[model samples]
Target: MADIEIFTGPNCGYCREAKRLLDAGGYAYREHDVSQPDAQALMRARLPRARSIPQIFVDGVHLGGSDDLAARLAQGPL
Candidate 1:
């Protein structure tokens, strides 16, 4: 399995959906809640122009948000 990271904020619907997809796909991931101060700083460092929630990374590669992840999943397995 690949190392996965999900950067998200509280009350984000996309974040929840992303998590659900990962769970259903049987992929483990590290979730960083950007709503927290430390995680927020980390997310900003990673994505300077991230004006949205649920920024996802797969094996250190940026896979974008929930929609992006879903699209990737739709194409094939990661």
Candidate 2:
């Protein structure tokens, strides 16, 4: 299985969509709520220039946001 991590904020639709796609693909992931200070700091450390929520990482590689995830999913397995 791949190591998947998602950084999300509260009530984010894109975050929901991203999780849904992962779920549908039977991909297990660790979710970090960026609303929390520690998680926010972690996310920033991983992606310094990210200006949005639902930033995803696969096996420590940045995969960008929800739309990018969708595009990646469309290509094949994560």
Candidate 3:
């Protein structure tokens, strides 16, 4: 089993969708709410270039945002 991480914000629809897709696919994930101070700091440290919510990772690899996930899902499993 691979480790999955997702950085999210409370009001972010894409973040919700990302989680939804993960649930639908039966992929377990650790979610960090970047809206929280500590989580925000950690997210910035890990993904300095991420400009939006729903920043996702699998086994420690950055995987962009929700649209990126959708495209990847289209291809196959994440």
Candidate 4:
């Protein structure tokens, strides 16, 4: 099992999808809502290349956005 971290924002379908996938897979993760104060800046500081919502990290390793996560899921279980 790996520690998962997912960055999210309000009303983002990608965010919902990411959470949904994690839920379906029974992956317990830390969720960071970028809509909160300083969250966006925190995300930027933590993930400089983050260009969108639902940026996922697996055990501190950058795994990218929702589509990236989906592709990874298609490859195999984490």
Error of 4 at 52 (Å): 1.2
Worst 10 residues of 1 by lDDT: 6-15
lDDT of each: 0.93, 0.94, 0.91, 0.89
Candidate 4 lDDT at 44 equals 91
Looking at model 3, the pairs that clash are: none
**Residue-pair clashes per candidate, as listed?**
0, 0, 0, 0
lDDT of 4 by residue, 1-78 (tens): 889999999999999999999899988999989989777888999988768888899989989988998899889887
lDDT for 31 (candidate 4): 92
Cα deviation at 56, candidate 2, in Å, is 0.4
Badly placed stretches (over 4 Å) of model 3 are: none
**lDDT tens digits by residue: candidate 3, 1-78:** 668999999989999999999999999999999989999999999988777899999889998899999888899887
| Residue 4 displacement (Å), model 3 | 0.6
Candidate 2 lowest-lDDT run of ten? 43-52
Superposed Cα deviation of residue 19, candidate 1 (Å)? 0.4
Model 1 per-residue lDDT tens digits across residues 1-78:
889999987888999999999999999999998879999999999999989989999999999999999999999889
Q: Model 2, range 1-78, lDDT digits (tens) per residue?
A: 899999999999999999999999999999999999999999888888888989999999999999999999999998
Candidate 4, position 13, lDDT: 97
Q: Is candidate 3 or candidate 4 better by TM-score?
A: 3
